[model samples]
Target chain A: MAINPLPPGAGTAIGIDGLIALLAKLPGLGPRSARRAVLQLIKKRESLMQPLARALAEVADSIRICSTCGNVDVQDPCAICRDPKRDAGLICVVEDVSDLWALDRAGLFRGRYHVLGGTLSALDGIGPDDLNIGPLVDRVRKGDIREVILALNATVDGQTTAHYITDRLGALNVDVTALAHGLPVGGELDYLDDGTLAAAMKARRKF
Target chain B: MAINPLPPGAGTAIGIDGLIALLAKLPGLGPRSARRAVLQLIKKRESLMQPLARALAEVADSIRICSTCGNVDVQDPCAICRDPKRDAGLICVVEDVSDLWALDRAGLFRGRYHVLGGTLSALDGIGPDDLNIGPLVDRVRKGDIREVILALNATVDGQTTAHYITDRLGALNVDVTALAHGLPVGGELDYLDDGTLAAAMKARRKF
Candidate 1:
C-alpha cells in the first residue's frame, strides 16, 4: 500500500511521513487533512502532540475488547458491564463500538450494550458465528435479561442480522425492541430518502 | 477547558476519555469523529493503533525545530537545511512550516526555506521580532543570499509581512520577490475574487 501520500522532500524526516500516513487512515481524515494535522501536531509538540502521543501509547497498551459484550475498554467486562447502577436486565445491541459510543454519548440509555462487531454479510462472508450473536444469545438465554434492544442500522444486512438475533432469542422470554424510526432532529424532510420518510411516517405517534 | 465533548459514560473507560479528548483537539476531527477514530484504532489495535502510537512517540521524542530556519525535522538543523545539493544562496520565506512543506512537496524549489512562524498582525500583537525576519535578514547580511522569495499567503497581514521583510532586507544586495497572484489552476473565474481576476488579467501571458 502507498503509506505515505506526501512527497519525499515534504516529509524527508523519519517517522513524520509514517505518522501522517497512519493519521490519514483515520475515519474523518484524508491525505490533505492528515498533512495539516501532522503540521499542527509538530507545531504544538510540547502542548498537544506530546500529550496525545502519551495518551495514545497508554490507551494502546491498556485497552482491550470486552469478551462478554465486545465493548472496547481497559477492563475485560467493560465499565457498563461492571456498573451496578446500569440496568443489567436490559441490553442494547449495536453493530459496532462506534454505535455503542454514540448511544453512551446521548446519556439516555441506562442499560448495558452488546457490540456485534458487524452485521451479517454474505458478500463479505460474515455470518452469525462471526459476530457476537452467540454470546448475545448466551446472555439472553441465561435469563437475567428482561429486554434486548435491537439498535442495529436500517440497512438490509443490519435488519437481517437483527431478525436472525430476534429468532435466536425467540425461545427466551425477553422483550425485544428496535430503535424507533423517525425524522431526525434538525433533519429536513426534502433531504430524507423515501425509505426513511416512509418509515418515519409509519412510526409517527400523536405528539 | 472542557476537553471531551462526549458525555460521562461515553468515555468512562480508563485512559480512553483522555485519548478521545486529545484526538478531538486534532485538525479535521471533532468529538464525534474523534470517538470514531478512537474506536477504529482500538479495533485495529495491533495493526494500526500500536504502530501509530509508537510512531507518534518516536516523532515526539526526536522531532525538533531547526534553529537555522525554523523548519521541523528530526535533527536540530533539519535535513533540508543540511542538504548540500540545495541552493544555499536562495531562500523561500513562508508564513508557516506547512507552507514550506507544501513548496517542498512540489519538488520544484531547489532552494532552502525560512519559516516566518506567522505573519505580522498588529491586532494580534504580532510584530517583526515575533517572526523569523531578523534571522532571515541576518542570514542575508552575513552574505551568500542572492534571492529571497516571499511565498506568503495572499491575506492583508501576509502582504504586510512580506513588505516588512523586503524593507528589512533593503540594505542587503538580495533580489526579493513575492509569489505571483492570479486565479488558481482549475479555478472558475466566477468563483474568483475581483482582485485575483484583475491580477490574472494584468499578468496574462501570450499563449
Candidate 2:
C-alpha cells in the first residue's frame, strides 16, 4: 500500500505513521494493525513512545554485530561470549541472534554461541563465506573447543547448513552434535516451547 | 520479562530489547509479539527501517492538533476543513480521528469534520471541557454549516458525548443527524465495512 502524502505538518505525516510502517514490515502485521499500533503509541506517547523512541535512538546509535559470534550486541563480543561462567568449549551454533536468545531463555545451555547470520541457502546463493563458518572453524582449530552444537532450524536449508558446518568442524577433530531430529520438521527454533527445546537438547545425538 | 543489557556497540544498552519494550506498550501487543517485531525490523532495516526512521523523525517534528476540528494535524485548521471543495456547510462530528479517517476513506462525505477527541466518561472524569463541544457549537453558529452529522461511536460514553454535542448544537438551529443504529452494539465506526457505513449514513435519522 502507498502512503498518501499530505502537506507535511497539516496532515498525519509524522513519527507515528513511520513507526506503524516499520511495524507493518513485521511477520504478522498489516496496515490496519500498524495504524492501530501507531494510534495507541500516540495516545500513550509519554510513557510508551518516549521510552520507545529513546530505545530506538539508543539501538540505532550503538547496535553492532558481535565479532565473536555475529549476534547483535552493543559490544564486539556479546555478553554470552564474554561471560567466563559459560562453557566456551561447547559452542551452540544457531541461525540468528533470536535463536540464541531463545536458547538463553531456556537457561539450560550454559555454553557459548556461534550465530551464523543465516543458514546456507543454495537458492539464495549463501555459502561458507556468507556465514560465520570460517570463524567457527578457527575457534575449533584452536583445539580448546570440544563439542559443537548444531542448533539450526529443521528446514531443508537448515539441514544442509548443519551438514556443511558438521563436515567443516569434523576436519577440526571436534565432536559434532545436532539438536535431535525430533524437533518437529520444518519448525523454527524460536517457535519451540522451552520443554521441547530442552528435550531436543537432552536427546541430541552425534551427527 | 527482564530486558537483557548489551555491551558497548552490541547496539545500545537499550538496543533491540529497548525497542521491544517500547513496542510492547502498543495496543494488542505483548512482550512476545514485540520481540518478534523487533527482530523483523532489524532483519529488514535497510528496506524498512531507513524510510520508517525518516518518516518518524519528520512526523515527530511536525505533528500537532488541528485547533479548529480537534483532529491531529500539522496545521491549525487541517486540510479537510481548509479545503474549498469539501462542503463547509456540512459538518461531520466524530469522537476520534480514526472515525474521521474512516469516513474520509468511504469517500462519501464531502464535508468538514469536528473531532471531539474522545467521548465523555464519568468514570474517567471527562466532561464538556475535555471535548471540543464548545468549538463545534461555535462553528455551527459562525459558519454556514447546515447539516451536523453526529458520527460518535455507539458506546454508552460515546452516546453521552453525542447527546451533549447535540444539545449544544441544537441552540445553533442546525439540523443535527446521527448515523443510524444499524451499527452493531459496542462496535467502533472504524470497524464497520464501507458499505455498511454508507448505508448507515443514507438511513440516518434526526438526533
Candidate 3:
C-alpha cells in the first residue's frame, strides 16, 4: 500500500492539511468540514485564496488586544474606546469579543464597550484577575461613566461574572443595569437575532 | 459617518475586514461570525493561522478533482483510486466526496468509489452527463467490477441521480444494489451516526 504520505513539513509549514486543521480550530468548523473548506478555497484561489492569505498575514502582523477594553484592535485603544461621539457615560460590558460584534450588528448601543474577555467560572478557576475588570473600574472612577450595562449571558458563570463586576463597581455611585429576563435561559447573546437583542436592550432593568 | 474611512487601503489591501469577508463567503459563516473567527485565529496564529495559511496555499497549489471518481484530491486520480487493496470490481456510487468519507469512516465496503460530484436536478439543469456517470460506465466496462452500491442520499435529487446512474448501467449487465431504506426519509448519510450507518449497510437491499 504505497499510500502517499503527507509532504515533509506539510501542516507545520502550511499546506492543505494545515489549512483544514486551522479552520477546524474555529468555533464551528471540524476536521471533515475543514477539508471541504480547504478544497473550496483552492478551487476559488484567484477570487478567494490570495486575498485570504494577505488578510491572514496582515491580521497576524497587526491585531492586538486594546489595553483598555480587551477588544481586538489594530490600534492601542480601539475605535469605540477613543470615539468621543460614543456615550462614555454609559459602558456596556460583555463576555467576549463575539458578544461585542453581536451588539454592533444590532446598530444600537451608542455607548462604548467593556469586554470582560470571559465570565467568572469557579469550575474553570477564572477570577476577576483573569478578566479586564481593573481598567473598567478605573474608567468608572474617572466619573464620566454613570451607567454600566451587564449584557452577559444568562448562564451560571455569566451571572456570576456579572455579580462580581457589580461588587467591584459597588464603591462607585452609578446606575447598574442588565438585559431583562426576555433573554431565554442559557441563551448566548451571539445566538439572539437582531430584533431579540434590540428588544432585550430596550427592556433592560436595574440589576 | 465618522468610521475613520476604514483606515485607508484597509478596504481591499487585506486585513481583518478582508479575512472576515472571505470567511463570510463560506456556506454557513456570516459576516458577524466571520469577524469573530478572524479574531480567534489571530489569537492562535502559531497553532492555527500560520498552519492554516500554509494549508490554504498548498491546497491552492496542489489540489484538484479526480478525473475518474470526482473526488477532490492532490492528484488527478486521488489516493483511493491508486489503492490496490480496495476492490476496484465493486464501485460505491455517491453524491460527492463527503459521502465517500462517510462510507470510509464506517469501514464497511472495501470497494472503490465513483463520486457523481452532485445530484440530478432538473431545475438546476444537473443531469447524468454533468456527473461522473459516463466515466463510471467506462470503468465498469473495462474492469471486472461486480456489485455497484448506490449510497446516495435519500433526497429526491439523490434518488434521481441514483436512478439516472442505474438506467445508464443497465446495458453494462452488472448487479446494481442500493443502500437500505432503513435510512430515515430525507436522510443524509453524513449526518447519520456510525451505528446507524453500519446497520444501514448490513441491511442494504436491492435497487
Per-model DockQ against the true two-chain complex:
0.51, 0.36, 0.28
Q: In model 3 chain A, which range of ten residues has the least summed lDDT?
A: A7-16
Top model number, DockQ: 1
Writing each residue's lDDT as its tens digit, candidate 2 over B78-188 gives 666667678889989998888887898789999889888888999999989987888888888888888999998777898888788878876677899988766677889
lDDT, candidate 3, B110-163, per-residue tens: 878888878889999987778778888998888898888999997889988888
For candidate 1, lDDT tens digit of each residue in B58-168?
888888788899998876677788776899999999999889889989999999999999999989999888888889988999959999999999999999998888898
Better of 1 and 3 by lDDT: 1
Candidate 1 colliding pairs: none
Give lDDT tens digits, candidate 3, residues A1-207. 344575422322344455666788887677876767765676687888877776676677777677878777766577667666778799899988889978976888888888988888889998889888888899899857889999999788998888988898998989899987667779999888886788789888899
* Order by lDDT, highest first: 1, 3, 2
Off by over 4 Å in 2: A1-20, A123-125, A181-207, B1-13, B122-125, B183-207
> What are the lDDT scores of the predictions, listed in order?
0.87, 0.76, 0.78
Q: Give the Cα-based TM-score of candidate 2 against the true structure.
A: 0.79
TM-score of chain A, every prediction, order shown: 0.89, 0.80, 0.79
RMSD per prediction, one decimal?
5.5, 7.3, 7.4
- Winner on TM-score between 2 and 3 is 2
Residue-by-residue lDDT tens digits, candidate 2, A106-193: 8999988889989998899988899889988988897498899999997889989999988786767789998765578888999888
Top candidate (lDDT): 1
A best-first ranking of the candidates according to their DockQ comes to 1, 2, 3
